[model samples]
Target: MSLLKKFATVASGTLMSRIFGFTREMLMAAFLGTGPVADAFNTAFRFPNTFRRLFAEGAFNAAFVPLFAKEIEQNGMDGAKRFSEEVFGVLFTILLGLTIAMELSMPFLVSTVIAPGFTSDPVKFENTVNLAMIMFPYLACMSLAAMMGGMLNSLHKYFAAAIAPVFLNFILIGALLLAWAQNYDPLQIGYALSWGVMAAGVVQLAIVWFAVRRAGIKIGFRRPKLTPNVRRLLVLALPAAITGGITQINLLINTNIASGSAGAVSSLVYADRFYQLPLGVVGIAVATVLLPELSRALRGGHMQEAGNLQNRSVEFTLFLTLPAAAALLVFSEPLVRLLFERGQFGPESTLIVSQILAVYGLGLPAFVLIKAFIPGFFAREDTRTPMIFAGISVVVNVTLALILFPRLGPTGIATAEITAGWVNAILLLSVLIWRKHWDYDAGLIRRIPRLIIAAAIMAAALYFSAQYFETYLSRQAGLLVQATTLGLLVIGSMIVYFATVFAIGGASLSALKGNMRRRKKAAATPENTDISA
Candidate 1:
């Protein structure tokens, strides 16, 4: 497939997932609100999610996909299939054991690792522990699901893997609605959401498993064997694991600090959900499609193609992310109030969450750029470079958090996160340029100024629109008015951004139209056999 079509496939699936995720978070905010129950649930959810990203999304995929793609390139499909089984066997055993141990030690983890913010409050601390224990095993299911996702991506079947997360949100939303229907306590709704997380993992695993099988790869449990391929995968995975873990360590820090403040963890979580919608849609979709393509291109010694792919990925990410960042900055309050002001979530909670959302907005483009840039390194099987950069980002985040958190509270943590993201992105781009590993073409360079101009125009429009809407939205209005106003702002911002991009020649309508035509032709071409340099 052409890069554009491949990106489209991934982006479409991601869009669906993001929509459902937004729905799920909206229900969660209404049902549980930003209070003790929400705090406990957020803390509990972060535990497994943090590790899941570290292992499944970051370490495992960064290592697994390129190796798997190379195996398919070097030794044919059968050889790659066998290698996947061996790796899956070992991964399954290790993740299962880790999950059990984590679940068993939930109390100590909560007290020492997760809920330091609630140190003085025994009730919140205990609830976080209990909820975390119930949710801990979600890591295993998600880890396995990620493995299956890697395999499917290698086969160029991106839809199933990308859409699998939508199932997760669907199940969680259903669980929350069920709790509401039963008239259960809000805390009970939180518990249901936790269990729903595990259940969603199961459903996601099943979806990917079926997709793998449909692609003619059957995965099953086998006696764990340390095949050469499996050994190599483990070796490659180490740096990625360390890198992903370090990159996410700020979350751990934030959680630790949030423990001391009532509802801080939950407020961060709500804001994070908003940030993640765009990140997951654009950043992750691009990363997912880019890695395998870059890996294949590099292996085939197609340097120019690899460079072009990286450049386009960056452009596409910026195209979507810039407006998203602006929307968050201008509409954070209305967005938060619209989705979360009903039920138990009150105006005070909306204000706090919006503050964090705006702070996170400052970092959105950087975060998306990181997702695009890091794969350029990973595709060359150079995990160490990204690891070094991630380590630097960690230090920056920790230093900033330590300096600011005492005086600024949860917003300080948000500031620290955005600053770290900028540091990482700048370092990544600089290193890539200095090392001559990636470069943009004349077209890409010429269009950047236009893109910036377009973004400026959109930002102005959104700012004025948001200011105008705030007065009407600030009243004791119903959810419909808030939702409607926020929706209009988002729609207006997007329209203005895209129209300006086209008008200013940042991205012409004809150019994009031509891209679609080319994509169809590229997809019709057969796979090449000579993938080796």
Candidate 2:
């Protein structure tokens, strides 16, 4: 398939998941609000999620996908299957052992590192620890699921893994509904969500396991053993675990810092959800496709094609992310209030979340661009470079968080993150440029400024729309009225953004549609047998 088609497939599935995610968040806001329960739940969820990203999705995929893809591209099906099963066996064993240890030590960890601030309040501290223990086993399920997902994505089976997150959103939404229906208190609602998280992981694992089976790979339990391939995989993965985890590390820091304030962690989580909508749909989808595709291209000695794919991935990422950043920056308040203000989430909650959302907006493009650029290193099977840069970014983040959190509150946490994002992105781009791995294509270079200009124009339009609709949005209107006003602002801004992009020559309608046409041609092309350089 063409790169664009692959991207579209992944993106379409992510779009479904993101839509469901929005519904999930909307329900959460209603049920939890910006209260102690909300803070506790977010803290608990962040613990496993941090490790899930650190070891499972981020590091494992960066190292695993390229090697697995090469195996498939060269040695064919059986070779790939053996490699996968071995990795799967090792991953499962490790996760099981780690989950047990963490569960046992949950209290001390929570009291010391995870949420020290909660300790002064016994209720919050106990709730956070209990909720985290219930949810922590989810890391085991999701870690295996993430490996299965990488396997699926390597095989171009994007739908199953992409849609697995939808199951999570649905499960949590159901849990929230059950809590409401039972007239459960905030603490009980936290329990519901915690159980829902573990259940969702099991479901997600099953979905992708079935997908890998249908794709002609069946992996079963085996005694853990580090064969040569497994050892090599671990070697490549260790640095990547740290490299891919910088963002999450920053988030963990922010969570700890936010814990000092009552509802600050919840505020950060809510704002992050909105930012991730665009980041997931565009940046992550692009990154997922780019890994296997670029690995294949590079292995086949298609340097020109490799360069073309990288450039286009960046173009595509920014094409969507730039406008998204603009929308969030301008319409954060209205969107937050419209989506979340109906229940216990009052104007104060809306104000806090919206402020963080706008600050996160400043970092949206950088976030996506990092997603685009990191593959340049990963696809080359060179993770050490990114690890160094990640280390630098981490230092920048921790320092800034320490300096800012005391003064600016949760907004300071958001600021630290964006500043660190730019630091990571700049370092990545500089390394790629310095190594001559990514030379800016004239076409891409010419379009970036135009894209920025178009975004500026769109931002101005959104500002005016938000100003005009401010009074209506601020009133104690019903959900329907607020949603309608917010929808108009969104729809209008999208129209203006796309129109301005086309007018300014940032992207062409024809080039995008041409990708659709070329998809067929790409499928017909002979497979390149050169799978190793």
Candidate 3:
């Protein structure tokens, strides 16, 4: 399949997941609000999520996919199966051990690392520790699932792994409904959601496991052993783990700093859910498809193909991400208010969350660009370079958050985050160009400015449209009225953005369709293997 088709496959799944995610967030806002229970639950969920990203998705995808793809190329599916079983035994054992240790130390972790500020209120602290213990085991399920997902992605079965996350949102939404139906208190609702998270992890893992099996790769459990393959995976994964979780690490810092203020942690989490929609769809789809594709190309000594892949990935990433960033920047308040400003999530909550959402908007492109650029290094087995850059970004985040939080509050933490994001993204791209590993194809260079200009025009249009609809967006307006106005703003902005992009030559539907046509033709004729867009 063509790159665009592959991206669409993954993105379609992600967009569904994000839509459900928004629904889940809206429910949480109405039920839990930005209360003590909400803060504690958000902290608990973030803890396990941070570790899952660090140890599972980012780490394994970076270290395992390339090696697995190479094994398929060099040693066939049989060799790849053996290698996967070996890594699974070791990964399972490690995850089991880590989950046990974390559960045992849950209280200390909640007090020190997860949310020190919660210690001031014993109720919040105890709730966090309990909730975290219930949810921490999710890391084990997800890590195992991530290994299977890496296997599926390497085998070109993208839809299953991509669709697995939707189950998470679906299950969580069910939990919220149950809580609401039962008329549970905030604490009881938090408990339901925590258990829901744990259950979702198992369901997600099972979905991917079945996918890997259907892909004709059945991995059996074996005694844990440190074979050459497992050892090499560990060597690469350790650093990649750090590099992969850079965004979560920075957000953890933001959460910790924000925890000192009541409702701050919940506020940051809400705002984060807004920006994550685009980042997950565009950035993740590009990264997931690009890494394995690039790795196989490089392994086959297709240097020009590798460069083209990198250039096109960047172009595609910006084409989607630029307008997303523009929408978030221009309509943060209306979007937040329309979706979340009901029930306990009042105007005050909307104001704070919108402010933070706007700051995150500025960094959305940088965030997606990092996803696009890091694969260049990972496909080449250069994990340490990105790890070093991630370390620098972390330091920048921590320092700036500490310096600014006293004055600007949670918004300051958001500022620190974006500043660090731009820093890491610039460093990654600079090193890629400096090493001649990535070349800015003239097409990419030309289209970038056009994309930016198109996004700017769209943002200006959205700004005016929001002004015209201000009365309907106010707090006094009914929910249906507010939602209708916001929907129109979104639809009109999308129309303007796409029209501008196509008009200014930022993108080409004909070129995209032709590229796909060529890919399909190449697939039919095995001898015609060149499928460049």
> Which candidate tops lDDT?
3
- Flag regions of model 2 displaced more than 4 Å: 518-533
Q: By the lDDT metric, which is better: model 1 or model 2?
A: 2
- Cα lDDT tens digits for candidate 2, 1-533: 66777788889888888888889888889888989999999999999999998898887779999989988988898999899888988988888899999999999989888889899999999999999999998888888888889988888888888888889899999998898899999889999999999999999999998999999998877678999989989988988888777788889888887788899999999999999899899987988898888888888888877887888888888888999998889889888888888677888999999999999999999999998999999999899999998888888888998899899999998999999999999999999999999956787888888888999899999898778867777746667787788888788888998888888789888666656554434322212211001
lDDT of 2: 0.86
Q: Is candidate 2 or candidate 3 better by TM-score?
A: 3
lDDT of 1: 0.82
Across 418-485, the per-residue lDDT of candidate 1 in tens digits comes to 99999999998999999999876776677777777888788899888877777657646665776677
- TM-score of candidate 2 versus the correct structure, residues matched by position: 0.97
RMSD score of candidate 3 (Å): 2.2
Ranking by lDDT: 3, 2, 1
Worst 10 residues of 3 by lDDT: 524-533
How well is each residue in 1-533 modelled by candidate 3, as lDDT tens digits?
77778888899899899999999999999998899999999999999999999999889999999999989998999999999999999999999899989999999988888899999999999999999999999999999999999999998899998999999999999999998899999999999999999999999999999999999999999999999989999999989999999999998878888889999999999999999999999999999999998898888788877887888888888888999999899899999988998888998999999999999999999999999999999999999999999999999999999999999999999999999999999999999999999966777777789999999999999999899879998878888898888888889999999898888889876666655543543222212221222
TM-score of each: 0.95, 0.97, 0.97
